[model samples]
Target: MSLHPVVLITGALTGIGRAAALAFAHEQARIVVSGRRAEEGEQLAAELRALGSEAEFVHADVRFEDSVRQLVQRTVARFGRLDVAVNAAGTEGEPGPVTELTPERYAAVFDTNVLGTMLSMKHEMHVMLAQGSGSIVNISSTMGSRGAPNVSLYAASKHAVEGLTKSAAIEGAAAGVRVNAIAPGPVETAMLARLTGNEERKTAFLASVPLKRAGAPEEIADAIVFIASAKAGFITGEILRVNGGKTAS
Candidate 1:
């Protein structure tokens, strides 16, 4: 076996996931980054390679069970084993009042956020259990712990993710596979660009945050890297909030 570990990150083509790929690459960890965007995924893989890190791209859509399974299979095939798994693939559906939310919108959010994470973990953990050691970090949102206006669907999906994290951790403890979650606040990403239309809305969002600023993707990625590394070996089933104290208010 190589001295470096194998790290698999989903949704690694963009946002926080992209930052994490770079973070792990810098640590000399062999990386397998999976995402639906072939161009961006391949580009990131090339970037990692340029940094002298062993990396590969596996195209996958987490919402589909088969695609998620194939992603893990490809990772194992390439690296021979998986030491860490990050389920960072997620979606933000149309925001609206619960009464006005359509079944289509609800299903879309749940399918990608809840079902997607579950399927990815199921397949990843299967391999981990057999190896008798692994760690999983699921990316959730701060809204998972608190209710937010006009985001019931999204909030619910993240809450489900937290629940899955806890339950999986309990079950995997005996197998030496740790499971946890990372809940980030308003990070400077394309996903939050949708909420940056008006100055008042933007300020209001920041006002609740004690840091008085939006979080950077790199910051969130750092938290994830710590939780997924050997440093957090004794920790499991925790939702490490990287929300800039927004939930404090």
Candidate 2:
């Protein structure tokens, strides 16, 4: 990696994605923050610039191939190369049991969580493979490896993301490009509030974690920075769980 690598992050307007952008900026990495929200994206880019990191905001809806392609192209155009990519664009979708799952509901979750990840990796790898070096860190969840009751859609989507991350890692490994994922547990984010639905439910959920609390977004962001950095150079095709000991058993 260069002294100041160029990093591109999708779904960067809030939560873990937003925190990752800030973390990378503090490392003096040039960054491109992408999301559907133009206003928020621009604001994040400005904030990164204020930290003295070269930054830009690119509007991208990861669900669309053309949009993702343009996002990668624009990043390379502006920075000359893409050294890191964080695919954090995802949603909790409409949480419910398997019986309540409709095709629309499935598409709503899979499109963004699974298909979006695929598209992002597809385009990101194109540039990285040619460059012969890069790191891609995808966002996943602890539910990815465990069965959960109501949030079946979200869990299923993350399982697919892990599969994609492993497969992409194999494809990119020989080419000197690394692909991996960070599986977070319950984090303090807007999505968590929506997933749990109430303070009581939230407390119950946290109780399951050995930490007995929710993880802060910055904590996950710090892990992302390490996983995406050269410090984790030997790591690839692995899912690093940052779930507050939720999976320790």
Candidate 3:
């Protein structure tokens, strides 16, 4: 058995998830990275392997329960145990006002963000409960704490994630598992690029943030690594904001 712990990170192909994979790899943890993008996942796994860490790419669509269960089971079968999991796979739907939003778009966001995170946590917790120790980090957003225009459905879904994280953390604390959340501000990722393709809108969003700049995916990954490490053993049910001070306003 490997001396280091095993960490399974969802959405590990790009952006924050990819950054977290590298961060954990630096910590020498065995990494099991899962996502629908097989090419990206395999590419990332290769990079982690180059860093002298064990990495496996598992393709999963977190919206389905079977995929989530399979992800956990495969991690255990590969590394013999699971010590940490990061729920970071999510999407921002079409840019439209609440009244103009379609039910289908709303459902899609909820299915992937809210329900997917829940399923990841459910299956990971089942493994952790059997092991009796683990750590989980749910990737939330600043919108989770407050409402934002043109993203009502996405906001609502993240709020649901926050609620789930807190409630589940309380329940899992007794099992020696720590559950925490990270609410990141606008980070310079492909997702944010899609969110602010318009120059005027991008400038407006940047002006609203106190830092006057976007964050790096690595920054959010660092926060996840901190919470997943032994340093945060006593920290549970807490939401760490990595929003470049955006929530202060």
Candidate 4:
């Protein structure tokens, strides 16, 4: 990779995606932050530029192939090549029990978490394979590998993400493109708040973690940067768990 590698991130408007953009900017990487929201995306790009990294905001809805294709094309067009792509676009999607799940509910979560990740990888690999060198880091969750009550849809979607990450890694490895995923535990993000709902529930959830606390967005961002960097060059087809030893058992 070049001194200022071009990095593209989806769901860059908030949470871990936003933090990853900043973390890469701190490394002096050229970045493209993508999301459906134009205003927030533009602001994030400006912030990255302020930190001395070349940056741009591209609007994209990962659920659609056309949107994702345009996003990848625009990144390559503007930056010449894509060195790293962080697929952080996902959702919790109206958490409820399996008995309560409707097709509408399932689609709402799977479209963004599963289909979105797949499409992003499809297009990203297309460019990376041609270039013969690139890295892709996908975002997964602790629930991805474990079963949880009421959050079945989200967990199932993340399981699909892990499957995609591993399969894509195998396909891309021989072509010089590496794919991996970070399965985060509870993080102090807006999504976490929504998931927990109340302070009592949130505290109880954190107690399950050995660390007894939620992770910070920056912590996950740093991990993303490392796994996506040359430092973790030998690593692929793996899921780096960042969930405060929640899966230690």
Candidate 5:
């Protein structure tokens, strides 16, 4: 009902999620930053309010259904309605050869990256469908679209996210709620460092990209804001890639 949309971001304490929060704040959108860490969450909220965006920090762990459900409910309660939801909570699971993979490792990654996104979508959609207008963006990776060695679980999890986004989009389209995902390649985030693990490996990974460089979080954030904007009203079920030409070839 307001031109300045109420925005909710999960895993907002770091990486691309944090950047998206700042980007939306610059647009004067109301914000709710959700994370497992209350201290960091509250700090981010204060920072957003400092930027002139009305903000609140709602602690949430997407791996749990109740936490995610409470997060969406609290956002609606505080903001009067849900407008934009960004699912950015993900993990780079322990990398290993397929022969060395285990069930525990698989669940650890899927719980946060796959199941987490699903639960967030499930709860967010309930509110958006009832309101009859909203947008949801889930953060994915180039690995979602292509295969990668060692990080197969992470790749698979993101692939699941892509499917969830498209399925959710189709379900929400007629209800005036749009769902989409952003697939970034070699983003400059803590997760990237953890995945690459060393300078040499990081360099090699960047070289694989057609642009020969990693993308900044803010760059991906811009792409997300655009898709979440009314300018992209007709765009839904899209896995918008923001990977410096990583997939161009």
Candidate 6:
């Protein structure tokens, strides 16, 4: 791997993905910032370039195989290789009780959260395995390990992500590729706002965390960078949870 590796981050327009992009840029890694929004993706790419890293924005929707395939292909075309991939593209879907869920609801959540991660890893592993050395980080969630009310679909999708992570890790280890997932707790992001719905409810939810507050995007970004770095070379098939100790039971 290059000392300054090429990194691709899906869903890079905002929140944790955006934070990870900035963190990698600070490390001087060549970056591909991907998201569905053309304007926002371009703006983020510009911002990363301004930070003195070679960065480009690729429009992609991880829900589809072709888009994800092209996203990785374009990243390799631009950088010659992909050294790190952060499969951060995911959706919380509509949070509702299991009884209220429809097949459409399940598909919407699984498409992005489960299938998106799967497709992102599918394409990334193709490149990484050929190179014979690479790292992949999938963004999971605290819900992946345990169930939560009103967010069953999202939680189930993340559970699938963790399963994919471990299976890929085992398959890739012998081939010099690494796979892992970061299961973040409630982080301060737009997604969290949607999950909590309002200030009072948000505070009530935060009270459950041992830290008594939501984590910052930058904090989670730091963990992503670490997991993708050589410092974490021996680690794979692991779920690194960063949720203010919410899952520490």
lDDT of 1 by residue, 135-173 (tens): 999999998898888889999999999999999999999
Better of 3 and 5 by TM-score: 5
Where model 2 places Cα greater than 4 Å from the true spot, the runs are none
lDDT score at residue 120, model 2, on the 0-100 scale: 97
Count: clashes, candidate 3: 1
What's the TM-score of every candidate structure?
0.97, 0.99, 0.97, 0.99, 0.98, 0.99
Give per-residue CA lDDT, model 6, range 1-249, as digits (tens). 698899999999989999999999999999999999999999999999999999999999999999999999999999999999999988999988888999999999899988889899999999999989999999999999999899899989999999999999999999999999999999999999999999999999999999999999999999999999999999999999999999989
Off by over 4 Å in 5: none
List, residue by residue over 107-214, the lDDT tens digit for candidate 4: 999999999999999999999999999999999999999999999999999999999999999999999999999999999999999999999999999999999999
The residue-level lDDT of candidate 3 at 199 comes to 72
Report the number of clashing residue pairs per model: 0, 0, 1, 0, 0, 0
> Cα miss at 215, model 4 (Å)?
0.2
Report residue 75 deviation for candidate 3 (angstroms). Answer: 0.4
Name the TM-score of candidate 5.
Answer: 0.98
Two-way TM-score contest, 1 vs 2, winner: 2
Q: In model 6, which runs have C-alpha deviations exceeding 4 angstroms?
A: none
- Of candidate 6, the 10-residue stretch with the lowest lDDT total is 89-98
Q: Report the lDDT tens digits of candidate 3 across residue range 1-249.
A: 125889999988889999999999998999999999898889999999999999999999999999999999999999988999999999987768978988799878999999999999999999888888999999999989898789898899999999999999998999898999999999999988899987788889898899998899999999999998888889999999999889885
The Cα error of candidate 6 at residue 65, in Å, is 1.1
lDDT of 4 at 178: 97
